[model samples]
Target: MLAEPARKFQSLAMAEPRSQQRLPKRLSRLLVVGFAVLIGLMSVLVLNSVLNLRAQEARVAGTVELRNRKIELATDLLMATYSRHNSLVYQTIVGDPFEQDDHFQQFIKWGYEVGKARNALRAMRLDGFETARLADQDALLARIVELHDRISDLARQGRAEQARQLIAVDLRPDNLKFIDSVDQLEHYERDRIQAELDAARSASRRAIFVAVGLGSAIVLLACAIAYLTYRQMGRYADTIDEQMRALEQHSAQLKHEATHDPLTGLANRSLFYHRLTEALTRAGQDQLKATVLYVDLDDFKPVNDRYGHAVGDSLLQVVAGRLLGSVRTTDTVARLGGDEFAVILLGVGEASRISRFEEAIRANLVRPFEIDGAELVPSCSCGHAVYPDDGVGMDTLLHAADERMYAAKRARKGGAAG
Candidate 1:
């Protein structure tokens, strides 16, 4: 009786469905494949949108160039017409026949330029309205040319007075009308170009919106797939959690490395500028004052030359620590590379406050540092500039501070030489 019961239990256990046991693995694989497909689709959508935007930008650029060229040609035509009229007037007034001939030749040259500009303007692409405007301008230009030719003929025939009268009466009004027409045409072309640019921008924005929507959808789908996979793989949660923690730590380390000096671990130049900008902005809004102190290690180079780079680097690290200890928590201390460092002091109201802060930094740095069992004394030259007083900008403040720092350095050198 006992043997039969045990055999039945074994047979039941062996008969359980193996496919049901493998279902989670197959589901996980499916979710992974789906996620990959969604990502690929998203990439394709983004690329297509970018390509379309570039095409639209190219079109806008070409339209702008063409519009500018059209305006230039129109202006050239107007000026040439005016120059021709002036030359004709000059030809009539000049007493010397040779000089009169020379003025006539100049008039002919200007007429050729007008014809060339008109032809070029006609060759450009034009809308129906622009075409009509251009036609009207051409008619006006033709009338001006006719009047100019008549004036030239009268001047050549020694009818100077009659030529001047015709110019003052007939030529001036027609020339002004022609110039007005050219101005109108230029304005029309500029309006068209602006419309084209606006349309292109609108299209680009639409494409971006579509791309963003698609990308969001893809991300949501991927998240759903990931959630399902996570549900099926609950047994590996601890491992995933550990990896996430490690990744977060690595990301933090990378950020710190990017904004900090690797050796001294102080804020680097980029972070310094970022902080300085924020300080300046706050100072402006709060009606408070700030100061920037540019610091240079006076004898750091000799120390590096006498000792090796390792000792030099150690000395720099010590200097960074001293600088940090010298400033307020709200203040920023940064290593502007090499033996140079910067400090931004906030809410510095009076000149004496800056003097006190400078004195404290100097006092901290003047202490001797023990390196390689040898006593080494480091001295620094510091220059300071007040916000709004020196100038109301980061570059200006830094420049002012740098100038002061160099002046201090020069004074020290001079005193030592003396």
Candidate 2:
């Protein structure tokens, strides 16, 4: 007959499960938190990479602009230099027939302008241009300079007529040839600039396309991760909520078990200490007096020694009930240990109130007990300690009360006539 009940009890025990089997709420939260953290980290990386790419693209674009400007300046300089050369040669050759007053001045001005243009070309051209092309251009420029010098010398000798004749023979052909060569060099430079522009444009287009593709991929990846993480976080949140509910219930049950004495269903030592601290805190805050009544059973050990541990336990339960009945509902009574109990009065009016509470506790503790229908008697020695006056802390108050209880016990022993 007992076998069925035992099996049912076993089933109940199994159904209830141990505390270890429950999943931790923190673990679920950690998974959600970790996923969010990783997603945030990845998002940051993607954004930083995109920004760096844009910065690089901007740098490339700036370089392209600078290269294009160089091409423009070089082209303009070549054209200006060529024009100056044409004017110089034409004036020296043809101006003798016309004999214009501005002929020498025009020649000198053109020479200066051409020189400036050549200097600009030298400054603007790329270093990597073919050495042979550069050398040919330099040779042509030198020839132009020499031809101008020859024309200048003829004019300076006051033989304008002879200068004109020499200009027709020497100045015109050399000037035209130099112009043609410079034209060729300009065309070559144009072609090179065009190629560079084309290459830069193509690279810019490719870079922009690559950046767009990569940025899109990163955004899509981030969105996908966010979506997945959101879904996962939802599940994790539910799991955590369930675990939290379970934990709260478990915690409430544990609180109940921890605070109450198992034998007498009264407050245990932990609860008493907590209540004492709270009472003391309130007393300090409100500037009121709080009392702690320390009670230790006097003859209870004799009962345990004469009868047994079981009988002593029964007597203690009886004593706890009487003690609880004697104190106000607001007061806290706790079992410290074997035959030891403490009471915390929330708001004590005065020192006399503590004396009255001690009197009530002693009266109840010394009352007779009926255990298993057998008459028994129990007596307890009491001690009173007040907070913020006699002691400032829980430990100090308890210690003071315990000392008084021991002192009372010694006095009673001395009066026993032993």
Candidate 3:
């Protein structure tokens, strides 16, 4: 009957194998290959994601440990500097001749030692708290140097009264600032580390959840695919399962490479764009808007031109990592080849989110990049384009955003902003 053929056509349409009339061996191979590819692709993605998350957690842990050690070292140096200053002041007041020369030399030695320590601490500028501390320490060092020079002159002229007057006013204020700066720096470091540790822990939990959820879903999909293929194979008397499995595996590898950057294994341009599109689409549906920022590194080409690509590559990796740390988990960051990067701000319905994002990026890039013990000074040119208003399509939005970025870059070149 006509109804029977229609039902048969529906069954064929839903069938996993090409046709239900094929041989069992052929059908089974087809089923296996198709399912295998689907399963494999999902499995690889889940695995790679888990691995990247673990690596990031390890990096954060290492950074926390490094900051703690540097803070302890800085504290020790600061205390020693404070002690030397106090000793010189006392020597001048008490007229202690026998110990004066030796103490003066020791004081100068401590100053040099402190300077070295400060230089070492400068490399810890990846974190915002540390950068602030670095600025404070710079100011503190200037004051300390002035104090040292003045004390030496006072000692030579035997001007105890003048020395005391200097210490009481100018020297005392800087000493207070130094002590306060140290304490503030330590507190800031501890708080920042704790917050980062907490974030890492939360990210770990979320990553596990995602891996488990996706893994389960993939397994279910594979099972569904296999079952459907097996049913068709029974009708056709052909092999199916093996082919599906092979297909699944190949798909998984391709997905891994697509989502991850080949060099750094961080998210690639495609993945970033995909996520941004998804966010923008969602925002559009909700009648809201978000922001897309194009970040281009300033003066990066000169380094590549001078230091060779090996060092230049290292610099890029370092900057990428720092930029990642600067943004929120919801933000999508991607390197768009060369020294250009982009970040997408999700759910940014208001202007404040854009402001905060800009501030964080500026703060992170404000400090120089220390590469191979040499400071690599660089800045960023950032331009933002809002969703919905900028453009409704991804390609259109990106083009607008890029134009804005080049505008910012030109502005930087013209010395309008740093």
Candidate 4:
């Protein structure tokens, strides 16, 4: 009986941590899902608000356009009225039958234009003030039209003096009143459009404020949830401490493996490009100079073929260390691939400085290396291109340097043959 009880207690104790571990994972998953959903909701809300603001802006623009059109039509009508009056006055003074007939035709044309403008204005939606103004303007225009007709008839009948007197007394005053009424209507429309635009802008601003406030609130809620989740995680920290440390170490190793060559411990192609891009950006912003050196190890394949990949790898590692030691800490040394390496020299502006640096690297690399109890000498062909001089972009610089490297290699082979 005592053994059975002890076994049961041990089994329960073994199951406890597993159950506890599973609970935190489920809770964390829930929190993460909830946060993602909230962020998505916030994005939707912001996008909707932006779309709504855009629509409102479009509506305001249309309203402004309509108001301007109405004002333009009203001005056109006023100008046409003045032109009609001038034609009538001219007809009365000329006394030629043909001139009178032309004036009468011109007067009729202007009258038609005024009627069209008035009809267009009437078709538009209008507020109370605009409607009253339109009514008054229409009445004045009708009286002016009647006076113009009477003047034209008198001129046609050869009563030129009577027509001139009617134009001076009755037609001019009523035409002036009509022009004033049109002016008032345009001013009223302008004021109303401005007011509406102002109101819309205020409303848009308020909506933006509301959206910002809501986003902030959501962020705060997310932070609170994160804090609670962190606290819950803390409860199991002791249980998972070793596992967390192991995971962190694994992550660091993975990062290193991703960015560095496994054999030589130099930066790989991906990390090389990343650092090169960063250096280019910095140089552009600061107006500084930099250079890229493409280095190819001469006669490296014979050693690899003779002594196997192990010696070859060790030689590459020694070469990498030498390259690292040759440059400033700010510079980058990367292995692009087998027997191929690249170096970025920062703040190197002059050709002489780059030449000297390249010579140093070559001298260091040519030194005999004692690997696996065998001595070996290695030589490298180097080609360099300056920033903003050879090329500003990565691809251009790389191409220039690569071309120079091939030329150097060809020259070296030709010299050896000679």
RMSD of 2: 49.8
Q: Write the per-residue lDDT of candidate 3 for residues 1-418, one digit (tens) a residue.
A: 9999999998878885655556787878987886788777655655565466657556665766675666565665565655567566654644556667766776777777777767777755556766776788787778767876887679757887677667766776787687677768766766665676557656555555554454456456755544443343232211112322443464456456646666655677656755886888789888878888888988888888988788888887777887888888777888767788888887674667777887788788777767776688668888888888777666456667777878888877788655
TM-score of each: 0.47, 0.41, 0.42, 0.45
Better of 3 and 4 by TM-score: 4
Ranking by TM-score: 1, 4, 3, 2
Cα RMSD (angstroms) for every candidate in the order listed: 23.7, 49.8, 28.6, 33.9
List where candidate 1 sits over 4 angstroms from the true fold. Answer: 1-20, 220-418
Cα TM-score of candidate 3: 0.42
- Give lDDT tens digits, candidate 4, residues 1-418: 8999999999999999999999999999998898889867765665566566657666766776677677667666665665566567657756569978887888788778878888888898777887898889868867877887888889889998788678767876786677678778867766766675667657665665565556556667654543443343333333234433553465467557756888888988767866987888999999999899999999999999988889999999999999998888888999988899999987886999999888999999999978888799999999988898998866557767876887899899999999
Off by over 4 Å in 2: 1-249
Ranking by lDDT: 4, 1, 3, 2
| lDDT of candidate 2 over 296-358, digit per residue (tens) | 888777777877888889988888888888888888889876788888887774867777777
lDDT (0-100) at residue 392 of candidate 2?
80
